[model samples]
Target: MNTLDLHAEEFRQQGFTVFRSVLPPDQVKLMRNLAEGRYRACVADPPDRDTLRGGVSLMRAFEFGTAFRDVLALEPVIQVVEALLGDDCHVISQNVLRTPTGRGIVNWHIDDALFFPFFADLNIDPKHVPVYSLNVMIALSDVPTDAFGPTQVAPGSHLSGRRPERSPDLPAGWEPVSLRAQTGDCYLVNSQTWHRGAQNETGRTRYVLTTAYGRRFISQRFYPFINYTMPPHVLSGAGSRIERLLGAHDKGPYG
Candidate 1:
């Protein structure tokens, strides 16, 4: 099977998959530098508006640098995202997640909202997975070991048709899998999957460029919901794909 098919299969059954070496070393370094700069700035002068996910996220990060927008339409990753969410998919959320040492999202939870609570009592077909939102995690910093605190996810937990439990235990033999990634590695997760950031045990900090995509109907969340438009400078030389990912859409319900 082709690589896209493989990713589709993995995603359908496991709720998440990692694509190693999806980015180059130089690209990774550039993104990491951008995140570091933003984090430092946030620390220096807090923004007037509240930050998402507490203060760890550099909100709407893609708007800050070229590399961020460039990575959004990456051919390989886009192909997989489109194949799963359909060709009309658009970016719903994009931000840089930076976790400092001795800090991380230790709780397991789903993204956006629940998808299957009403169907929780029924049997879910393994062959068919209903995916709404997808999170593309680009590793800007090396997460070479558990100490570095890779993203932890429970395989197939998304098919549970319910929210993650208040306790740590999962159904059957399911256990959290640490995605020990390296700089430039990219991993995709179904937004409904049970996931959390393993605590950063090492002194090194963690940086991840997160881009969330959704079906055409899913609302775009570029923050400030109203009166937010893509900066003309950012789209000065961008191609059609980039434009679409940045919220360009042909006539829809509104029209």
Candidate 2:
């Protein structure tokens, strides 16, 4: 069977699916280098809004002007997301996530529920969202169980419709599962699934880029703000789909 069908079936049953080595090694290396460089630059001088109260969102990241976008636009990932969401899918937010060693763990939460609060506010059922939200996590390093804390997910938690209560143990063999992935592997998860970034016990920090996708009708975060002074490619197509998804009509030059 095609990978997209495989992923959809897995997600339907398990609430999560891992695509091993979806990204080629060369592309993964380039993206990882680009992400690190962007991270360093953001650290040295951050935009006013990016200023953090504590640990820099632990997930603060950049999207525009990187080879990473090529990966985001990959046909395999797109097909999988489209299968899960629908035909008219748009890119949501693509951001970097970092877990520093010795730091505390991030809270367990669902992506769609946290970002799109209006679903609950408007009293709209999540089942009717057109395109179901899906989070595509591309691993940037080897995350093992003992050393690097990747992510802990409660399998089948999306169906629960609420955050699963955390505990040291569960009734059956069903406990929070830690996702340990290699550099080029990718994990596709239901946006409503319960999960969190586990603590990084390794001597260094862990990095991953999270690209979110949703049906075209739903709004999106992280609209691209391409710099005008940059090259034509950067400024022309800035925020095309993002603007539409966010329900705005501010078209860019390319748009």
TM of each candidate vs. truth: 0.93, 0.75
Clashing pairs in 1: none
Show the lowest summed lDDT stretch of 10 residues, model 2: 223-232
Residue 234 lDDT (model 1): 78
Evaluated against the true structure, the overall lDDT of model 1 is 0.84
How much is 13 displaced in model 2, in angstroms?
A: 1.2
Tell me, by lDDT, which candidate is best: 1
**How would you encode candidate 1's per-residue C-alpha lDDT over 1-255 as one tens digit per residue?**
998899988998899988989999988888888778877776776573344457678778776788888888986988999999888889998888888888887788898789777566777775676678899998989888888878999988888777776544555667899998888889999998899888889988899889999998899987778977767777878888888877788888876
Q: Which stretches in model 2 have alpha-carbon errors above 4 Å?
A: 46-64, 114-131, 165-174, 223-232, 235-255
